[model samples]
Target: HNRAGKGLGVQLFHSIEALKTYVEGPTFEEPVDGITLIQEYILSPESYITRCEFVGGNFVYAVKVDTSEGFELCPADVCQIGDLF
Candidate 1:
């Protein structure tokens, strides 16, 4: 799911019995390749984009994905493609 600013990834398992039954025995590493719940924290897309910037000419452009529609400095149609970095 797209959690926006929340840097979390979640996976749900049915039950503990199902997990144990699939694994048979608990070990550091499973031999038979059992289904085990796993979770990892990842950086949010907004955060990822904020860390990256595009530098061209004399301007430093940051990823402003949530900027207001009325905040445009130049018109899309009139702006030259090559001038947009």
Candidate 2:
């Protein structure tokens, strides 16, 4: 919101249904400038999901829900988990 130079009056919705109501109602007029809404799924840390990205000057990785193989092995243990499922 800060990145876009729009009016200060902005409404927030807690659910998709609420957002749909706002957009479909006759009282609402679509902003001429347009609006962008971003929705992200929330997941637990033990889901075995990996979020790998380039950050800083190197590649950074993170796991959601479960500890990854790279996490279980570090330093000397790195080779032990090489064949881990």
Candidate 3:
């Protein structure tokens, strides 16, 4: 999951310990590393998330991200392979 030797971005976890384990554990082939983020986990009403972009008064773009698939939310196409971010 190491793309050009950089990690994929933010992930939401149920607990701090789970997040800590993931950060400390060998989820990667190399040593896993990260900052501990403590945030409230909000349960979404839908399985998919909607992202919208606007240009002044005009709505430019929107997309639905299915959380049922998984969390790999990179905006770049190059970085979005395999995980379908």
lDDT scores in order: 0.38, 0.49, 0.60
Each prediction's TM-score against the native? 0.19, 0.33, 0.43
Candidate with best lDDT: 3
By TM-score, rank the candidates, best first. 3, 2, 1
lDDT of 3 by residue, 1-85 (tens): 4343223454677787887788688762342443333457578878876777777989998876666655555445666567453
> lDDT ranking from best to worst?
3, 2, 1
Candidate 3 global CA lDDT score: 0.60
Residue 37 in candidate 1, Cα distance off native in Å = 6.0
For residue 38, give model 3's deviation from the true position in Å.
7.4
| Model 3: worst 10 consecutive residues (lDDT sum) | 28-37
- What are the per-model C-alpha RMSD values against the true structure? 15.1, 15.2, 6.5
> Which residue pairs come into collision in candidate 2?
45-64, 45-65, 45-66, 46-65, 46-66
Off by over 4 Å in 1: 1-12, 25-37, 40-85
Off by over 4 Å in 3: 1-12, 28-40, 54-59, 73-85
Highest TM-score: which candidate?
Answer: 3
Worst-scoring 10-residue span by lDDT in model 1:
67-76
